[model samples]
Target: MRPVRGRWLSWLVGIAVALGFAVSALAQDEGYCGDEGVWLQILGSGGSELTDQRSAASYLVWIDDTARLMVDAGSGAALRFDETGADMAGLDAIVFTHLGAATTADLPALLEGSVDAGRKGLLPVFGPSGNDLRPAIGDFVERLIGANGAYSELSSFLTFRNAAGYKLSVREVSATGQRRWSRFSSDVLKLSAIPVHHGGIPALAWRVEIGEYVIVFAGSFSNQRDRVANFAKGADALVVSHAAPEAARGELREYHAIPSQLGRVAARAEARILVLGNRTSRTLGRESQSREAIEQHFTGPLVFANELECWGLPDKEDELP
Candidate 1:
């Protein structure tokens, strides 16, 4: 009986040791667990141009492994989001930079995907109110999920607590005339927006703060350099869309920021990291030139984002685990 007890204890100890190693392996491979820090995942990194290699603009902001917010739902973002193995049911809000197809076409896919993933209750959505050329975010949601809208059946199919649950509560930020402004805040996060010139369309740049860390999304801005710099002041990470090259002129200049412009914004904002997103085939191979242009003014870490890449922010030692 003594020998049998000794064998049992040995087996138990071996099992515990193996389990510990397994947990450590998981933490190392994923980096999502055991790390108390903010993370940014690029879902889609391309622009309006459809390529087999890349998707349009979308990003997921995760706080301690739980997805807190989604920024821009561009083409193919849903699939990229799925590949990240994140819980869509945990998403708190969806913020759109602008209503362009490259920036917002995959919203329905995300809505449907979330419902399929057991998302319940209201999904808060925030975006810029439209001008004559575009539809406001509220109007856009109604068009997609209203009584007779395109995906109206979603309301019937996805419900919780015996009621229509998969609903969107839309908040439209109207900074039509304002240069820089803030609108949304909660206990854990604060959201701010500023009007950005994206050709003739109504566009916005967004900044999100979680604890001591700050992330600024310089969404598709052109020529509002000072406003963007002010809005992104001292951000930890600056996400800028590389829409066109520095030499682009005329009407093209009104729509997108060149590489040098993006670098200048990051430098002036005092950002630690610059993520160059919204890449196209034209700008894919010219990374060195872009980096050179950026280095001329900004001396920060530059990352050319791709789909499903996860970036871990610097951990604050004083924060609670």
Candidate 2:
């Protein structure tokens, strides 16, 4: 995502003033995933609404226009992904971290894309089974890919065949901290999933290991740092929410980690690069405090991502201790 600078910052001034400048985008830099390889792109970063500074959480990871897998379809993600010039047909699979409103809001737009592409079979979707409080994976599938699908028969040209729909494969992770890894086979990359703590919510974090490069995407959680630190330890990069700086743990005691907390966690796990997303809707002053706090904790390759900002490791083996 382009940094909300100059013009964009001016627009947010009247709205949240300094919030626009809090997460300054890193300088325009070329990315790497080992010898001209794959990379990860941030489509949206905000938590609830798309803002001048952030969009809801969504990401696209691919290896050169192909081998694509999307994580989360939060508000405006499909539209923003389209804007990134990614090929719809190139999408191999999709995964959701949880079923929260801000997390699963982009299903219709994606299923519609499937119909438009005349896809021959159901696209594979992976997520933990939902609980009483949240929509189960099956219900989520029915709402979007079932016969009475949410966007069923919207247009005459729209053809959502049973074969040309989402074929879900749900996997339940143990409630305890034990991690389960499932692999997604595709021509472009190998996708893996592990359940993480999201406050009694059915949430799953994903790690896509694509040809010598590994990137971890964490969902919103109350204790995500520990879960990811164990599951994604030593990954080349970690894509997570930028809730605040480490010192803001007092404010984030309930559900999210300040950047400093995230930084320390990433450092302990030996993750080389850090990308932050899913910022909350606090005022600009508070957001700035959190951002500054994160800067204090992390002294590695840090990036304040924006909508569609592409990034990756500078070298694959460099991730090794």
Q: How close is candidate 2 to the true structure, as a TM-score?
A: 0.77
RMSD of each: 10.4, 7.0
Clashes of each: 0, 10
Candidate 1 lDDT, 78-110, residue by residue in tens: 887777666767777889888878887887777
lDDT of 1 at 118: 66
Candidate 2 backbone collisions, by pair = 1-306, 1-307, 1-308, 1-309, 46-55, 244-258, 244-259, 245-290, 245-294, 246-260
User: Over the full model, what C-alpha lDDT does candidate 1 score relative to the true structure?
Assistant: 0.72
lDDT at position 113, candidate 2? 62
Q: What is the C-alpha lDDT profile of model 2 across 1-321, one tens digit per residue?
A: 222111121222223323443324432344322223566777787788544466688988757544388888888887876666665566777788887768778777765665545444445667667777676766766666455776555322233324344343443433334657665578657776666666667777788877777888876655653767777777777888765445554536456665666767777767776777776655233555555665576555555666666654455434222
Clashing residue pairs in candidate 1 are none
> TM-score per candidate, in order?
0.83, 0.77
Worst 10 residues of 1 by lDDT: 1-10
